[model samples]
Target chain A: MRIITAEQISAAVAELCIRANRELPEDIVSAMNRAAADEPWPVAKNTLEVLCRNIAAAEEMELPVCQDTGMACVFVRLGQDVHIEGDFRAAVDEGVRRGYELGYLRKSVVADPLRRINTGDNTPAVITLELVPGEKLELTVLPKGFGSENMSRLAMLKPADGVEGVKRFVVDAVRKAASNPCPPVVVGVGIGGTFDKAAALAKHALLRPIDCPNQDEFYARLEEDMLREINSLGIGPQGFGGHTTALGVNIETMPTHVAGLPVAVNISCHVTRRASMEL
Target chain B: MEYRLKTPVNREELNRLRAGDMVYLSGEVYTARDAAHKRMTECLDRGELLPFEIRDSAIYYVGPTPEPPGRVIGSAGPTTSGRMDAYSPRLLDLGQKLMIGKGLRSREVIDAMVRNGAVYLAAMGGAGALMSACIKSARVICWEDLGCEAVRLLEVEDMPLTVAIDSLGGNIYESGPAAYLESLKGGK
Candidate 1:
């Protein structure tokens, strides 16, 4: 068995939070570059160019690409052979609190939705733990901003709705989102499973490298078709109008009940940030 | 069209602006977003003076990160303007002239802009680091407990913005896409 101390876990997570905010993943950065180069509309092209500058400036300034440093979403892949000392959740929260403070990232989390008071420290990260077979413990800190998150949608379609219905729902959601989600956006579509699981699958799908297609040929084709359709909407970069409304489309699916055809669309801005480490 | 605009931009200057035009704004701009907007509106409702003057002011819809050592401000970028729609029309009627943010405005907010001779500008969203470069200085005005959401006064030099909505009711969110779609149809 591999033993990981909470102090170690907390320290790693803190660095991840700082890293995720200050630096964007290379995959996301390249996707934006490709979109900018390929955009047709003049306004859209200019918008993409400016966005690239932002990315570059962020690296130089050691600041977050966006001011909405977002809620600390921690994803942990824990191995069955691993034993963690101390309270695991508390360790994660401590990391977020210190990371936001040390990194000068915004503490955007609120203690209660209705109460609307700032939590002071960006504590109590949204944690997702999955148990796997290996002895290595992997942690990914996804800083998800609300601009794109608020634009996401879900549908519980009838079995008859099928693929076409899913496509329509996804396109309509993007159309409705328009300039709000900060195009060129990254879309994650979750099909199958129950309602909540489908939503989780959609978000999880975003962690997949944008350049890598789903291993399944069928899902890969669906992603391409949806990307084409979404770009056809002329929403472009920043929705100022162009051919690159979405940088990529990713779909995740799993087996579901006979009655269920659940779908969730998780939209991410160009600044989609996640940093991972293994302990 | 591109223009160099300095606040407090008056009704005449706003009328010259049109949707889709790029502008570089330089002057003292006030910052506030969801939380601070709520607080400001509540203060007005109680017949209390706001912490800063609103008339002819350019209010930025942003919640910036904490500044690092020696820097005047942290990464400061616009938040969604839609969230403040409910409170904006009242501020517009109070003679607030310019609003800097990203995203579509409510129809009611647009109508108020047209009525009040105001304009909406879109600062490049997610360009916080770059945006902060334009801001020379920042100081909290009120609601410090709100942290990032506290209202601040920022002195910016040549802050780039797109005229998303002009005083005459032109809206880039509507026109930009429709024009692109029309050209696509025209091509075929």
Candidate 2:
């Protein structure tokens, strides 16, 4: 069995947290550039330009792209043959604490949803683990800001509601979100499965690269159709108004109970910061 | 047209602005997010004096990252404004003239702005690194225990913003998108 130490995990998590916050991933950069070129309104175009410049400045100055350094969402895909050498959860939280403190990134976590006391170190990261086939442990860090997170929605539609219902719900969510979640946002739609699974799938859909299409022909077309419709809303960049309301619509689905048509829409801002490492 | 606005912007200056006007704001402003606003309102309820003056001052809805060594501040940007809708009308009634944030405000908030001759401005969302360059100085003035959510006094220079909602109730969030959608319908 391949053995991985908690120290190694902690160090890697810290580095990834800092790096992900500062750098705009290449795909996102290219997508924004394309959006800027396609955007028609002058105000929207200027907004996109400023967003691009912000990304560039963040990289050049080694600063975070957005002040909300975000809740550290650590997703781990562990192979069956690997054994972890120490306390896993505590090590991950420690990594986040060190990362936020050392990188000068914001510590945005609170101890409770209602009590609202700052956790100070941005600890107790939202960590998700899944078992995979090989010896490699893959880690992906997605720093999710609450602006968009607050805008996410889920609805358990009856089986009769079908595709049109899903379409309408997704469109309405984006329309209501307007500039709140920071358009041109990424729309992650999860269909089928149970309620919680649908929500999780919707979030996971956001982890896909902006340009990648779903492998399924049906879902791929739905994504395309949704993207076209959302942009047609003219929410534009920063909601100043134009044609590029969303950078992309990504859909992930699974088989669900015959009676249920569960769906969730998780919106992500233009920054959409995420990074991955394999060990 | 771009404007260079100083702090304690009078009602006359605010009334002259309209939705969609670009602005480069300079001078002192205060920072508060959800928690701080709750506390400030509660303090106000108890007849306690706020740490900073509210009259004619601009309040930015932001909780900035901690400053790194040698930098005046860390990445600073506007937070979602909708969350502050509950407390904004009351604050606006209490003589807060300008608010810097991103996103939509409620009808009551807009009505309060119209009634009070206040204005709402939007900084570019997700453009924190660039925005921080405009802030020349920042220091926590109260609620230090709240960390980033503390009330801060900031001196900004040429901080770019767009007039999202004006004193006259001209809301760019509604009108801008409607106009663009209408233009598209006109085949522009």
Candidate 3:
């Protein structure tokens, strides 16, 4: 069995925290460039220009692109054949504490939601673990902001509602969100799973590149259709009115119960902050 | 569609502005959403002094992120105005001039805007960093205990904002999107 040291995890997390804040992933940057090419609204096109420029400037200056650096959300895939040298959660938290402090990321996470006091370190990151068959551990870091995260929605539609219901839910979500999720948004649609499972899948869908196609042809088509319907709302970038309402729609689906057709829409802003590592 | 404001705002005069618009911002407005509105109306019942003089002054519903170093502020973006619906009408009774923010305003806030000759301006949401650049300075006038929620006196210059709801009851969030969609459909 391969043994992964705690020090290595800590170092990787520290590096990812700074890198993710300063760098816009190349895939996301390329996708924004493509969106700018197709965008028809002058104001939205201008906004996309600013977004692209911000991405470039952020990299050049080693500064965060957006002020709300977001809460650290780490996805870990641990291998059954590998052993962690020490306490995994503590090691992960320590890494996050160090990253937020050193990276100058916002300490947005409050100890209590109602009282609304900051935790100071942004520690105890939203960590999710999955056991896999391989010997290597895979980790993905997503710094998720509240504005777009607050806009996420889940629905448990009847089996009779069918694809039409799914499409309607997505369209309605985009319409209601209008200008709020920072237009030229990316809509991650998760279909066909239980409640929590659908939400998780929706978030997982965002990890994919904006321009990439879902392997399932039918689902890929659904994504395209939703993209068209959403942009047709004319919410445009920053909701000032234009053709660039959403950059893309990504759908991820799995098998579900005979009675339920669960759908979740996880919205992400143009910033699209995330990173991945393997150890 | 062009309606003159009782409290006129000349375009040239508005050109030289900053991130936080401070023009003695008059010309009819409504109030809506969240924590501030709730307390404003509660104070109205007791006839207490509001944090700022609400008469002829616009109230923007926003919750911004904490500022970073060598920077004036963080993601100072607008929140949904609908959440403030329950508390808006009371302030409008005192002649609140304008309500600024994003999302759909509640029917009550809209009614107050129309009745009180108020306007609702839509500031770009999620354009916080861009918006912050326009703010010259921000000082807490009241509610210091609210932290980021304090009533801040923001000095702004030439802040770009669209008139979403004018005194004439022109609803942009509703009509703007529909109009653009129609033009697109008609192949304009």
Candidate 4:
């Protein structure tokens, strides 16, 4: 078994936190450029121009893309063929704690949902671990903002709704959201899993690169259709008038029980901040 | 589509602006968001003088990052406006004339804007780095313990904003979408 030292995890986590906070990802940059070029609405195009400029400024200033530095979510894929030399969970938390402090990220993680007490250092990252069949471990850090995170929704629709029902629900969710979630958004739709699994699938869909394909043709078509429908809503950039409402609609699905049709729509704004590393 | 607004503005000046009009804001604007708004409103209920004056001044609903060295502020952008809607009408009634934020205002807040002759503006959300460049100066004026949520005073220049809700009940948030949607149906 290949044992990875705890020290390595610590250093990587610290750097990941700082880098993720300071730099906008390249895939997102390319996607935004493409979206701007393709947007038909003048106002929405102008909004994308501001967004591109913001990305450049953030990089030059070495600041985050948005002031809402967001909640720390770490997804770890641990390999069964490998051994960790130290307490894995503690190592991860230590990375998050050190990274947050060193990065000067906002301490947005609150102690209680209702009381809203800030946990000074953005610690206790919402960690998800899956054991896989490799010698390498992968970590993805997502800094999810409250504006879009608050608008995430999940539902178990009857099988009758099928794909058409899914379309309606996703459109309605965006409509109800209106300007609240920060428009010119990226939408991740997860379908066909169990209720909880669907939600996770939708979130994982966000980790996919903006230009990547869904592999399944039907799902890819659904994504295109959803994008067309959502943008047609005229929510536009920043919810003011424009042609582009959503940058992309991504759908990730898993085979599920025959009796139930579960779906979830997770909306992310232009500031979709995430980064990953393998060690 | 552009007008220069002066602080401590009254009914007449505000009435001249409407939703979707571009406006250049000058003069003093204070910053507040979820925590600061609650505290300020509670203090108002207690009949205490607010840390800053509300009459005719604009309050930006934002929580900004700590400034990096040599910068006035960092990654300053508008948070969702609905979160502050509950406290805004009360403050508008207390003589606040302008609110700068992202997203739509609640009906009650818009109504308060009409009755009190206040205007609402939308800054580009997620455009923080660009937004920071407009802030010529920033200093904490109150609630420092709140960290980024602290009430700060900002001096800005050429900060471009669009009127989203004006004193005349013209809401761009509603109208912009409707106009485009109608055009879409008209196939224009």
Q: What is the DockQ of each candidate?
A: 0.86, 0.89, 0.27, 0.74
Given candidate 2, what's the lDDT at residue B129? 93
Residue-wise lDDT of candidate 2 within B131-178, one digit each (tens)? 999999999999999998999999999999999999999989889999
Question: Which is better, 1 or 3, measured by TM-score?
Answer: 1
Summing lDDT over every window of 10 consecutive residues in candidate 3 chain A, give the lowest-scoring window: A58-67
A63-176: candidate 1 lDDT, tens digit per residue: 999999999989999999999999999899999999999999999999999998899999879999999998999999999999999999999998999999999999999999
Query: Which segments of candidate 3 are over 4 A away from where they belong?
Result: A1-11, A50-64, A113-120, B1-48, B58-65, B141-147
TM-scores vs. true structure, each candidate: 0.99, 0.99, 0.83, 0.96
* lDDT string, candidate 3, B73-160, tens digits: 5555465566666777777777676666766667788788778776666666655555556566666666655544557766554555
Displacement of residue A60 (Cα, Å) in model 4 is 1.6
What TM-score does chain B alone reach in each candidate, compared with the true chain B? 0.98, 0.98, 0.78, 0.96
Tens digit per residue, CA lDDT, model 3, A110-163: 778797655768877888899999899988888887668878899999999999
DockQ of 3: 0.27
Q: Please give the CA lDDT of all the candidate structures.
A: 0.93, 0.92, 0.72, 0.84
Poorest stretch of ten by lDDT in candidate 3 chain B:
B14-23
Off by over 4 Å in 2: none
Give every collision pair in model 4: none
lDDT of 4 at B14: 82
The recovered share of true contacts, given per candidate in order, is: 0.78, 0.85, 0.23, 0.71
Better of 2 and 3 by TM-score: 2
| Candidate 1, DockQ score (0 to 1) | 0.86
Give the higher-DockQ candidate: 3 or 4: 4
